[model samples]
Structure formats: C-alpha cells, structure tokens
Target chain A: MNVTTGQSTDAARAIAAGRRSRRWGAWYVTEHRLRMMRTYTGTVVIAGIGSPLLYLYALGVGLATIVDANMGPDAVDGVSYLVFVAPALLATAAITVASEEFTYPIMLGYKWNPTFTGAAASPIRPVQIVDGVVYSVIIRMLVNLVLFYALMVLFGAAPSPVGFLGIVASLLGGLAFGTVIMGYTSTLQEDTGQLAMVQRFIVLPMSLFSGTFFPLAVFPIYLQWIGWISPLWHATELARVFSYGYAEPIWLTLVHVAYLVALIVIGWAWSRRIAVRRLNS
Target chain B: MPAPVIVARDLVKKYQDFAAVDGISFEVASGESFGLLGPNGAGKSTTMRMVGAVSTRTSGELGILGLDPDVHGPEIRSQLGVVPQSDNLDTELRVRENLLVYGRYFGLPRKLVAQRADELLAFAQLEGKEKARVDALSGGMKRRLTIARALINDPRILLLDEPTTGLDPQARHILWDRLFRLKEQGTTLLLTTHYMDEAEQLCDRLVVVDKGTIMAEGSPAELIRAHSTREVLEVRFGSDHNAEVGARLARAQGADGHRVEVLPDRVLIYSDNGEAELVKITEAGLRPVTSLVRRSSLEDVFLRLTGRSLVE
Candidate 1:
C-alpha cells in the first residue's frame, strides 16, 4: 500500500473557515451544477447558435415566400410574413430550450447519477438544490435566448428597438414552461421514455398550435383555446406587440405578463416541494 | 466524560405500519469509533441516515452534535461528514473537482477548498489521478475519493454506511487503513457493516442489529464472550449425515457443557474447550470428514443471539 503524509490539521483549519450562512450553500450548489454544464459546453454552444439559423432559414426565408405570394406582402399584422413570425420563433426557442434543459439533467440529479443525494449530505437545504438547478437552467435559457435574439437581429427579423423586450418575454415564457416541467420531472422515479413522449405530445403540439408561424385569429374559436392555455402563445403575442408594435389593449398585455408570472410562481413552488420530498424520502 | 456527539433514544423510523428502524437507543461519544453490525434488511443504513440528518426519524430523539436533527438539521449537518452506502461522486466532474465542489457545499471558500483538494487527493492516495474523470476511475479509487470528499468539511463525526462493501480484499484493507488513521486522529467514527472482521477491526464498540432491532451491544470481544463460548468447533460429517451427527451431539450437550447448532452444510459445537468437545464427539464412534476448532467471533455471537448467520 502507498503511504502519504496527511495535512489533516491544515485541512481542518480550512473546513473550520467555511461559512455557515444558508445562502452561500445555495450559490455553491449552483456553482457545482454550472461546472457540470461545462462538460457539454460544445453541445450547448452548437444548439444555441444552430437552432435559430435553421428556423430562420427554413421558416422565415423559405416558407415566408409562399405565404407572401398568397397573402401579398405585409398581409399579416402590416409586416412581412418573415418579420411577423420571428418573435414567435424566439418564444418557441425559449420553450424548446426550457424543455431540453429541465428534463434529463433533473433526472440525473435525482436518480441516474444521484448527485443531489451527495449534495443533500452536505449543509445545503434540499430546496436550495431545486433553486440551484433551476437557477442554472434559467442561465442556460438566457444564453440561448440572447444568442437566438442576436441571430434574429442579423437576419433582419427585428423591425423596432423594443424587439429586445421580446427576449424578456421569451425568458418568462421559458421559466413558465421550464420550471413546470422541472417540477414534473422531479417527481418521476423511473424514466420509461416519458420525456420523449413529452417532446412528442406536449412540447410539439404546444409549439405547433401556439401561433409560432401564424396568428391565433386565423384559427376557429374552439381551436384557439390551445393558444389561450399555452405560455408560448401568450409570450408570442407579447413579443409581437413589442417587436413590431403589434396592436393590443393594455389590459390584455397585462394578462400575458400575469399568466407567465403565475406559471413561474406555481412551477417554482411545486419544484421546491417535490425536490424536498424526493431528497428526504 | 466527553460529550456524546450523537445520541439516539428509542430511535424509530416507521414507514406506514412497518418500522424500518424500530425502537433502538445508542450513543457515540466524541473520538470513539462505533459500529452498527447487521445483515441486509437490518435497518443499519436507516439508522445511519437518521444520524446523518438526511432522513427524518418517525418518532425518536436523535441529537447530532447535541443539536436536534428535526430543528437544526442543516446546522448539525454542517459539522458532520457522511459517506453513503454507494459512492455517489459526480461522474461529470474531474477527481479533484469532486472534493472542491463538495467542500463548497459546506460553504467553504473556493481557494481553501482547492488547496485542501490537493492535500486530500494525496491523503486518499489519488494524487496523480486528480484530473481523471470520476467515471473513468476504478472502484477503489472512487471509494477513496468519496472518503476524501466526505472529509472536506473536516467533520467532527463521520458516518460511513457500508464503506467497503464492493471492494476487493486489497481495496478493503487500504480503506480500513485510512479509517484507522482517521480514528487515530481523534475523529469520531460511526460505521455499519455485516462483515464480522470489519466490526472487529475498526469498531471500539458495536451494536448487533437484525430485522430493525438491536439484538446486542458491546465491544466485539465482550459480545463474543457474553453471547458465545470461548471457542467454536466445526464438524462436517458430509452434508447427508450432518443432521444425524448434530442430533446426537445435541443429546450429549447437557453433559458436555456445550451447545450444538445444525446449519445447512456443517454443525457448530459451542464449547469452552473445542478440541476436547471434538475428541468426545469422535470417541462416540462418529468419524467426521473434517474438523477444526477456532476462537468464537462476532459471527458466533450474532448466530447465538438470532439463530441465523450474519451473512447468508
């Protein structure tokens, strides 16, 4: 066996220097998860840069031509079809990023790798673990939103300076969707391909029906309810209002912001509860 | 007397109608190494979790570092180091980062944690492998790193649940050596293991647990002496006829001052003078296939207490 002299006394001094404040513990948990993110930085960067260009090229440039030829240019919302669809695409990006960031990593924290249990053994509270994970994902969403927003700018998608407000709406929309998905994922004990089903059934349908490519007014009254419940739709409408000054009443704008805020609060509370329950159980 | 770092009075952890850890009481004094000896399903891990302040006790008093686990869990946990049954090192992080990140969980300064990480890597004999990914490391390396990570907080008391369960003999001995060093440094240690030799080697005192209850509590030597005779005589008369030999031995146990236990493959005769007992058995016109006499161990004590082997 190999023998190495231990600096037990120095190590003890260092440990004794640790802060007992609860907030630092939460920050440290966030720090650790952020480092975990660095392992897949390549994938993150590619997704951040690639997703927006593909959507803009495929939908804005390619599909916009047919819509323009049929409806005449500026037929929808008094702007070109490309400009009108851009804000919704940004909202969709945020929601897509939210769904991607929240599922597998949360499962890894709870089950596959059980890194959360390792943190649970430390001084950090269980709810802080939830906060830390959500915090990291929000940061990831912000980055993705910024990169996509920049692409939207370079592609001539933004027609007004207030289009930047679309980024805020996208983030709120992501949190509303991401944190709720996070709460649901934390309660899962087994994978069983459910997240794939979520992508297939929930995320896909929400993106398609949330008026990302077309206005909800074009849909029949019954089918428009999908846009009402969907966070993406609320965010898209809010973004359009900001991006190209898409007309809407003041109270209706407040409803969009309130809906996103409510979803965030509910999702935040649920994720905290589920995380604590699972860790202590 | 030094204060007990951990005290549990009638500790009970009930899951609905089933008590995972039934009413059991014990204390671990500062700097004293204690063991919870039990087989699988014995509630040792459950008790350890309660003491570690990770799992809530159903109805019991568990005071860690003289603080109530229910109210001061995070505070108490800040001062304690816990090594769970399985090594849950972050496979995504490098070997050194595992210690640094875990140290930060205690709110340690990153600079200090980084400095201590190097020293701990050396202490755990993982010096050159600091940059290796955790998943890329061998089992022994991973266990050593886990131990090092637990020590990042320099906890006054360390709780280890089956620390060396999956390790090979060499690895187990290496880990035992590290734990012995920790004990020598006056770190209070609490561990759970079903291996009798592990209990004997590391524990200054131990409590035998089975089916969620404490069966006996004492030092390993004292438990062996109290619950079993000084020596155990093993006599195997072929699997087919061992039961017949065991029955004959049981009939003579009263006169011989011994006890006979018939197991699946062999019969164990508990007696002070095992050689003399073996001679008496052979003199009764029974030629055994093989026989040996050895000093009784904690395995014998557990068998005498529960009528079952410690590791089945």
Candidate 2:
C-alpha cells in the first residue's frame, strides 16, 4: 500500500509539471505566417507591388497627355488627369491588398495545410488560433499598404497635403474587407471553386462599381446603391474628402466612418465564432 | 495507484445521428505501450482524436495527464504528441524547416529549436534531407519527418494513428525500429492499427475495438489463450471438395472431440493438439490435398470475438 501511494504521488507530480509547460497558440501562428512570407516573398514583390506601380505610370502619366490634348486645361479636377486618379489609385491598392491577403491565406490556414490542427494539438486553444491568423493578416495588410502609399507619392499620384490620409483610409478599407472575408473563409470545408468565384464575381464587381475608376454621381440613381453599401466606396469617398476636401455634411462623413467600423467589428466577431466552431467542434 | 496516465469513464462521441465512439471506458498506465486494435470505421481513430483533445466528446468524462480536456485542452495537449494517420506535412517548407517551425509553435527558443531540429532529423534518419522540400522526399521520409516534428516539444505521451499504414516493407521496418527505440526510452505510446502483426510487435497490452466498443482487452498471448484453442488444423481438400471434407473431418474428432469449422476453401479443426487431430483424420481415411497445423494467434481471437477478420 505504501509503494502504491508513492507511485501515485510521483505520477501526480509529472502531470503537474506537464501542465505548466504548454506553449502559447500565438507563437505557432506567427511561425506559420513567417514561413508563408518566405515562400511567397518573391511573388508578392513582383505582382503585388510591381503591377500596381506599372499601372500608375502607364495610365496616369503616359496616357494623361492624350486626354489633356482632347479637353481643356481643367478637364479632370483643375489638375492633370494623373493627379485626379492618383488618390483613387491609392484606395484601389488598399482594396486589392485586402482581397489578396485575406481570402486564400485564410483558406490555406483552415483547409489546405491545416497548420491550425497541428497548433491545436499543442497547448494553444482555438480562439488563440483565430487571433494569431487575424493578427498576421492585419500586419501584412499594413506593410503592403504603406509600400503602395509610398509609391503613389513618388509617382505624383497624391496631389494634396491631405492625400496622406489616403494611406489610413486604405488600411481601414483593408481591415473591413479582410475581417469579413476571413469569416467567409472559416466556414468553408472544401475549396470547391468558391475562391475563384469570389475573385471574379464579387471582387471584380465591387472594384468596378465603387467609384475607384470614376465618380459615383455618373451612375444611374438605382445602380448607385451598389456604391452606397460598399466599404470600398466609403473608403474612396473618405479619401476624396480628405484629399480634395469635398463639401459634405458632418452627418454624411460620420456615416462613412460608421460603415467601415461596423464591418470590422461585426466581421471580426463572426469570424472568431466561426473559427472556434470549425476548429473545436 | 499511479492514477493512470490516461483515464476515462463512459466517454461517448456522437456525430449527428450516429455514434462514432459509444460509451467506453479504459485506463492506460505511464510508460506503457498500449494499442487500439481494430478495422477501419471501428471508432479507434475517433477515440484517439478525443484523447488528443482535438475532438470534443458528446458525453461522459475524459482526462489526459490528470487534466480535463474541456477546461485545460491546451495545457493537456502540450504534454502529448500525435501522429495522425494521414501525412499532412507542410509541403511548402523544407524538411528541416518543418521541425524548426513546429518547435517554434511550442515557443521553444530559436537556438534550442535549431539544435533540436538537427538532433531530430538525425534521429529520424533524415539528416541529409534537411534542405530538401517535402514533395521531394519519399512517403517514408515524410512520415519520419512528421514523427520527428511531433516530438519537438519532448512530449511524455505519443499517440500514433496507424503509424505505418501505407509504407513499403523497408520503410515499415525502419519505422518499427524507431518506435521500438522510443518505447525502450520509457515514452508512453498509444496507437491504433488494423494490422495484427503491428499490434503483436509493438503493443504490450491492447484492446480490440469493434463497432465503437471494446470486444476484448489483454496481452497478445493472454487474449489468444483465452479465446482460441492451443492449435488449429487447416485442411484444404481442393476448392469444391471443402463441404465433403468438412463433414468427414467433423466426424473424426480430436483428443477432446471438438467440432470443426467448414470454410470456402479449407476446414479448421480447433484443438489443443493439432498433430493428434491430423493423425485421427488420416486414420479415418480422409485424405486432404493440403493440410497444416499451427498455433492460434490474436487474429483468431479477433475473429472469435467480432466474427470478422481484423483487416477486412
């Protein structure tokens, strides 16, 4: 009986030591993000950065001369066509970064590689797994937005002192889109061509209708509803308001900020719940 | 008295209308090599998943390392290592990067992770494949790497779900060797396998699970002895002649005069002395085209309990 008691005490001590040494889930997710960056750094630099800069130069500077010759001096905004489209380009870059970084990467984490499963087998809980993934996406979006903003300034796309706010607006736009799309990605079990459909049907239509390429007033009254509900439209409107100081009521400005903020909050909560269900169920 | 390294009481896991793991209870001691032996869809994997704390139980209680998974999932998991049946290696990373990244998930220091990665790669016999991409390695190499990655945290309990299901003979032998070494080092191993040979080789004591419940549990020899005769006599009198031969062999009994089983291709006569049965059959003028006598094994025990082969 004494020997058995001694054995039981030793077992209790070993288990106690085991519980004390568990790893945090955040460390696991950060490692996955770093590995992802290493694998795709070359592609990100060439496609994410290079393509946007080339478009800015080719359309903003190269084609602006042709448009200026056809119209009077103030054909765009009492400034060159290049200057008018520059801030819009900054907003566009932010939306693009959000779309690219959020959807497929979230799918990869949940479905394809299932690194989260590996992490869950450790001391990290499912909620921490969700937090780590969101944290990584936010970091990536900010860095990419900053680099894109710098390029916009260097290329003479940003025309006003308030144009710097376009960077902040772009990040807000990305956060709104990323948080929402991550929620969608978390519920999906299999790939089933949904991601491609999102890129083509959803992202393409939103980019076209959100006034990134043209003024929102040109659209028919009913069609304008597409821009009104869009986070991109809100971001673009905020960027235009800051860069050109568009005359608007204080209530209207508040509405724009409210739209983006609501998206970030609701999307984040929904995604976190979905992640917990899918991973821990 | 050691409080059992793993303990469960009436653990149940249900998926919608179906119960994947019905109410079952068991305990495993520290440093013991235990096995869940069963066929596919026998609920062994589901049981392992519950023990690993990845799948939540529908009812009853389960505790790993003296902690409840519901409240302390992360705390319990940190001390446990799991090798899933399927190889889900990160194909994007190199062999060495896989181990290093897994160590980092446990929040190991960078220098410590590097040192452990080197040691594990060598231990898994993947020393020279460090820089090689996962896709570039063979099935066996990838499995070894996964095992090494699971051990990066120096876990006390290792759970393996069919560790060598789809490997070549050489790879299977290599894996068996490594597992044997780990067992000798006093690591508690819990494994699931449909292969009786694998269970016989590795498990000190095992539970034969069938359709979500344990059919029997004991050491290999004890199980065989308890559920099967000491020896079996197999006689195949051609394919179509089995029925006639079975009738004749049934009349010619063993020393204890037990009945015989008639199979499609052969007849099995269960007895303590198979050679004596064979002599009685020959003296009765029942000439079989082929005949053999062998000791009963765990396969027979499984067949007696479940009425099906272990693999099928």
Per-residue lDDT for A72-169 in model 1, tens only? 89858898888999999999989988898789988998888999999988888888998888788878888888999999899898989999999999
lDDT of 2 at B200: 89
Q: Highest DockQ: give the candidate number.
A: 2
How many Å off is the CA of B135 in candidate 2? 1.2
The window of 10 residues in a row where model 2 chain B has the poorest summed lDDT is B250-259
Superposed Cα deviation of residue A237, candidate 1 (Å) = 1.3
Clashing pairs in 1: none
A259 Cα displacement, candidate 2 (Å): 1.9
Q: Report how large a share of the reference interface contacts model 2 reproduces.
A: 0.42
lDDT, candidates in the order shown: 0.88, 0.79
Per-candidate iRMSD:
8.7, 4.6
Best by lDDT: 1
Give the Cα error of residue A261 in candidate 2, in Å.
2.6
